[model samples]
Target chain A: MADGTTTAELDAPGDLVSVADRLDGWLEELDEPETLVEGRREAWERYRELPMPQTASEEWRYTDVEDLRPEDFGFVEPEAARSVEIEDLPATVQEVLAGEQDRSGVAVQVDAGEVYRRLDPELEEQGVVFAPIVEVARERPELLEDRLFSSEVTDAEEKFWTLHRAIFSGGYLLYVPENVRVPEPVHAFRYLEREDAIVGSHTLVVAERGAEVTCVEEFLSPDLEETSLSVGGVEVFAGENATVRYISLQRYGRGVEHYSVQHATTGKDSHLSGFNVALGSDRHRADVTSHVEGPGSESEMLALWFGDGDQHIDHHTLQYHKAPHAYSDLLYKGALTDRGRSVFRGVIRVAQEAQLTDAYQTNRNLLLSEDSHANALPNLEIEADDVRCSHGATVGQVDESQLFYLKSRGLTPLQAERLLVFGFFEEVLGRVPVEGVRSRVRSAIERKLGF
Target chain B: MADKLLEVRDLHVTVEDEDIEILKGVDLEVDHGEIHALMGPNGSGKSTLAKLISGHPSFIASRGEVLYEGDDVLEMEPDERARAGVFMAFQYPSEIPGVSISNFLRTAINAGRDEEDEISVFDFRKRLKDALELLDMDESFADRYVNDGFSGGEKKRNEILQMAVLQPTLALLDETDSGLDIDALKVVADGVNRIGDQNQDLGVLLITHYQRILNYIEPDRVHVMIDGKIVESGGPELAEQLEEQGYDWLREEKEPVSA
Candidate 1:
């Protein structure tokens, strides 16, 4: 904090492993409760003991993270609470604020830049909590203690998750009390536009019995330079007969290396939707899962991405059915252009007790450039004889007849191509349940396409 | 620059990848304000000539001259040729999902106009609405995707609607009468006749296997094509002859020349 630019602990640069080794003490100092300090200490020790996942690991086969040196990134403050007024925001944000969208609340986190939160008064009166997780931890410790780091992804997870749990700088928590259904969606805008920085952002949502809420979280950046590392995790807890819709849109700058883990655990007869749209990031890997721990639960997982330039996007998903009469459907679609590449690996696992389970998974890719490539692996593991599971994957170029038809109508080649690509992506984007989030996502994709 | 509205001379065309010639030395001409029908048997290369004139990538015209309004139509891209007022109604129009009819039409309408002279929303909407009514299309059809789930007759009628909107100087209708019932054929024929009345100087080259469409929209001249060449040229009475007595007699008559 000498010059107020770089923090004291991260001021000195070290090699990758050494920097990975030294982040624990900073996290320990940053925690509020002594319990979190202990949690950070133990998680850090475990993170050090575990080796980083490599290309040799089957889960990381197509991904290469060797060039990501830990010493090149460090945590910085999100500047300050500068100009939180709606008009002073980005044009997209301003446009969103202009209309009276169905919104319960909105929060904007700009890098270590600034944080602005606006909670609907009526919703807040109804005991809907949308605030920093730290505040929630202080006010309602019991609610978070049992749920924090309780992801079914397991304690022995990959290195990024281990690091995230160890030193996650900031995150949000949304809590909907029993039977208090929220009518509008909660918007969270997370902007990471820092130079050579590491950001660990997390979000946790808990919907009690019969409660319903939708959360839309988007990652953004106006100006990006050098390299930035983003480690994000989102976990949802749905109680009996509750419903939760979670949308995560990552359209960060191309100078980013983003890794995310999103998972949800649903109780009896609950429904959960985890939608993801990854359009930016030079290299990105996202692993999303739904663990149906209760009977008669259903989960819908959908994802859409358009990779331009030489960006490499990789996605892995899981539909883990541990209870009977569970249902899950997953679809992932992408369009690649100009040497861009994408890989999709998904699995639907039904346990023996999960009889009468139904699951389906499909992945489709359209190649807009000859050199672009798509790799898909959709797998199913069923231990129950009474379960039905199916998976399909396809990779092909745009239909030639479709192109010729548009061109014959006087559209230029590039315009005709972009229209087809957008049509291909609509299958996934159109499924988003939040209207504000959907339009903002559309605009983001439009901007990325340079239209 | 030239009195001839559309001219084709010594056209020798083949599929791009193969040596098999589809059109061998085709010669035809259509004066302004005239309608010419190219009646041919199946696989006789009538559609191939239309595709070649519009610069379709699949076909290569090895030797030919196609002059449209004094411009070399063969030297242009399909889109450029279309912008230059040479229209080709596809035999099988492609389907595009998620692109609404309104947006597609608006884009096409704007593509050929200068930046400052781009069609205004009010004018474009008026034109589209008028065309939609003329085609008997439901107003809500404006929001539907282009040809994605259209019936055969609907797709052909839509093609005619596009031709009316574009107001091309020359139109090449390839099998527009195929796969259509009498009612649909009359509707499509009426749409073409409407275009003819609106653009009196327009020239049309209508290619069809059957002369059924001719009963509604009369052709000024008729040319019988076989084995990629125009074997015979005659008046409207020839279509009636072909309709009553199929193409076998003509095939036998042109055996020596075709071989």
Candidate 2:
């Protein structure tokens, strides 16, 4: 409770510190887990002590985070009537949701900081806790005490994480007991819909030893004309020999700003794989960090993005090997057209204790138009004597010979170029193990290409 | 000679971006049902001649008139030339990923077919099967990406498969046997031979630097090209002669000494 209180106080807005006080008062009304309260408070204090990240920070170099001022956006609760109306779902998202038939697991919908839907009775009976962050704090304090904000592996890298910790209002939390495997994917969707609306959603997933689960978090909007901001953080903990797959698809409409931090910690012999497909947003930035802390662990990160018409997609990735005999492989591919731009900065760091680590990082870009731009910076920092680490970045255009060959075979130039671009994206899109997600991503890419 | 399938007169061409002319002045004529083998050294403009006749945009035809069945081909686009019965098997084929061989071959065939005609999937499959069988290629090859991960012999064989499907009037085999081993070369040669026999009206222009392919599909006329001009014209015996004497002896002789 002390740590949670401190965190709330530290996160209190300067002019509107009373907002934090009011939030704390609201949190006290719920039945929260004691341990979670302490953990949240400690995270709050730590966040208050940390300074805002500037361009000097290696992770913040390419991304413009200075424009993200807390004073510019204030917390505003979503309208209850519109929040509960399912018919307001965007046409694209409605189409996807209507097509989905397998709804066996938990289904959650969060508008702003309010939870509109939750269906997880069987999970509750199996000792699996699936609830909103505030409820998780009130009900399972012990779980939050040690695991809530205690996973500090990615705290030092970005200023947004601290802000997320300080101001996060509500998010989804899931915990599966040891050896428990959820057959269906847990689905959560977040909606940011309003002018200057700011949302801080926190997602914490912990899979006990030998547990298996799949989680999908989707970010979207109801209207393209609204100016909105979203800062999200996701932390995944995989216990010994556990298997976890986390996928995040961000498709915010035009004029929306998004920033996200995703971190995964793997235990001995554990496996964690993540896929991110970013499509929409006027300005979007993401930091994905994977920490391999135990031997025999492996992590795979895959991402695909298509930027068109003044959109900017910036991604920073960190593959940290903290223990020996661990491995990580990351592959990111993107295509830019119609004056769009993208920047990818990836780092593979092998710590002193992480000997015999095998890590590889690669980023590839295809520039379809002359005005489209792509900048890639791949780096490596190795302190271990016995390790294999390599990084590469490539930027190229459609091969003229390939175009001629396809055209010679009766395909128009545009058709041929489309096929080649699809082939270039197949390397990353093929790795998405989920069929529905893959199809959705493909459809989004096609829409972006105006197909 | 009156049923000439291809007629080129005083053709002059140069490589793009350079004043160095490759095809200085060349004249040749090939009637229907004739396989003309053009043998030349590396820089004698054998490939440039093929491009000029096939309407390749990179080669500048300074002075030449290519008439295919009395239609001037210089005004046609590359694809138009292809549809108008000019087929050229590239010396080095480009690899196209994500486009399957069946799709590519079907598109090419449909493009060349009658405008009112449409190929159903069933008919396309049957045609593909028959073509693959004629080429002795595996059925799985049709489903693979076009020329992607294909071996040199497989690429050349795939080219011939295309030729068999499209059934072009004039087929230009440009160095198709360059990288193939003995077995692969035999397979490619046999495929070409089958296509030639099936389409008697097909005028074949076999461009190669080696005489091995001539052993399989005997050419009716062998034209020795030197400095972009046909210097010697004779039967297949000229190919055997050139194979033995090399181009050095022919390089020294300035005039067209009858073979």
Candidate 3:
């Protein structure tokens, strides 16, 4: 992706420059495999060569990063994390865990440190691996050497993507073997408590043929007085006949800026479903994509965001159907109140070889206040003549009729509005297969709605 | 002493943003435990009166008074009026996607009660179960979103279900029998009758364009409204007369009655 885009136009931000200079120190602290060490070095070099994304670029038309003062955030120093019990985790994390007890495993990352991780013995005994990515690299480097830095992981050429690659800590890895179906979902909680700290985390899931698994990851932090930053990446691989469901809940507190790039590729007859809930963060940009690589593969992408305060949430999604007879559907819904703003752009690309592909994309936004705003842009680029592809986008205010109906049933105006917003997101929430994830997402939305 | 369960005294209502009046000084009264059928032709201001009583913002009560148990009902917000035991069964109920009927009913029940008196989940489930059974609706109906994608019959039955569960002292049935098949109309009517029978003090104002529904759920008195005013009031015989002759006679009579 180094297509001669010169970085000479501008100097790197001081905050990110400081982080880049500490890469050697980060590498020294984590005794990792040679392959990963080389990967980090390459990523850091690319980070230096790439330029910060500008709003002038089409991909960032709605989000402006020039106002970001990342220097206000201090880099989290790497230290040996003291292992703690599940009970010792933060109260918020405990509350999340309390809602779901039928998990195959749970991992907690605090301030870019793995504090607690557990995998059911039965699954572990069956060669299923759920652990920190660094540990997995050190123990079984072969498992990641070919897949970690592969093109399937991230096609993004953005500087944040490279920055995340170079500095990510306490990364998560979930690998299921062939023909093994994990009955319960494995959960991960990434919590940041230190004020004004820059942190990065990476999550990778690989399912072999006929394997089935569900993973739920949440990013959480307490509201901070100063600005903080997070650059994260997520990659998923569903093998032949495999099924994988990933639910990501982003609940970073106010004064936090987050950038994450997520990509998934499906195998023959496999299904990959992803649900993203963005409720917090002062400024967040999420780029998600589903690549249907094999015939008969199915990809379902869903996201719901509730923004309030001065939050600015931007989401861009792509459904790329590269193989014939593949099916992909995307649904994104959001609600904004106060001075909150949201931007959603989605594209469905059907390649020439993807004949008979069935693809649909929809984005709906409910602006709850006059000051709140939402922009939705849905596009389609289809090269296959026989494929069926359609896209739709809508931006609307709360329906007075709906509100009146609820109010007439005895609910107050506030309660009625909240219920309407919740119901607006119900289309996506109802499809979330994981009960625990669904409940947690609902609670996060309630929290945003001040319930 | 409380004057009546509901008393509309020379009520004048107007459509918002329009100079034309929808209800011109109409007066009516319903006593406790009485079922009064309000019969009118389309666009004769029958629904307007019901909406004004329920505090629908689309219609303005430009003048006059709506008293509930001798208290000013128009002064209350829609929700407050609901908590005060005034309910309206709409002709075309608004469909609330994604909210289950059971959930909406529970929230409505809770909204009517004090915090300390919130209904328990078990009790709510039982109440919903009973209401559904009384409406002859499948148990799964409670799990579906409120009136979403429901057939006309189902929507009317749902309104009756809500009426049964809420047990309001006063119910304004706005053309509840308009879009129902015979069997569905019977089920919905039976639901209303059962609830009315259970609550002896329940006062119902059944608004309908046709008198077919009165066959199943009888009304103590029937009032014919023409041109936004009650032209006549009598017993069940009034409904039978309107059914045989239609509303043209009443529209022509235009004789104001002491309702």
Highest DockQ scorer: 3
Flag the better candidate by TM-score, 1 or 3.
Answer: 3
Q: TM-score of chain A for each candidate?
A: 0.90, 0.87, 0.92
- As for TM-score, the candidate ahead, 2 or 3, is 3
Candidate lDDT values, in order: 0.81, 0.78, 0.85
Residue pairs that clash (backbone atoms under 3 angstroms), model 3? none
Give the per-residue lDDT of model 3 (tens digit) for A1-451: 0112222211112333346456667677657777777788888787777656677877777888755544334667544444666566788899888876899988878876777777888998898998777778878877786577564433343577777777788877899999998999898888877665688889999999999999988999888787778888998999999999999899888878888889899999999999988988898889998989989999999999988889899999989889999999999999999999999988899999999999999999999889999989899998999988888999999888888878888999988887887778888999999877777778878877787
Candidate 3 i-RMS = 0.9
**Cα lDDT of model 3 by residue, B8-82, tens digit:** 989899989988998988999999999999998878899999998888999998899999999899889999998
Candidate 1 CAPRI category = medium
**Per-model TM against the reference:** 0.91, 0.85, 0.94
**Candidate 2, A217-243: lDDT as tens digits:** 888775446566787899999999999
Candidate 1, residues B1-259: lDDT per residue as tens digits?
A: 5668888989999999999999999999998889999998999999999988877889998998888877788888888988878888988998888778888888888887788999999998898888887777788988778888999888898888888778888999999999999988888898898888988889999999998999988999999999999998999999999999988888888785654
State the lDDT of candidate 1 residue by residue for A1-451, as single tens digits. 0011222221223323333545655654563676766776776777677766777776777887755654346655323233355544566555666764668888876664334677778988898888666666677788787788778674324677876776665577899999999888888877775667787778999999999999988787654677778888888999999999999888777788889988899899999998988887888889898998889998999998888888999999989999999899998998888899999999899999999999999999988788999999888888999988999999999898888888888877877877787777777877888776677667766766678
User: DockQ of candidates 1 onward, in order?
Assistant: 0.57, 0.32, 0.76
Better of 1 and 2 by lDDT: 1
For model 1, state the Cα shift of residue A105 in Å. 0.9
Best by lDDT: 3
Model with the higher lDDT, candidate 2 or 3: 3
* Ranking, lDDT, top scorer first: 3, 1, 2
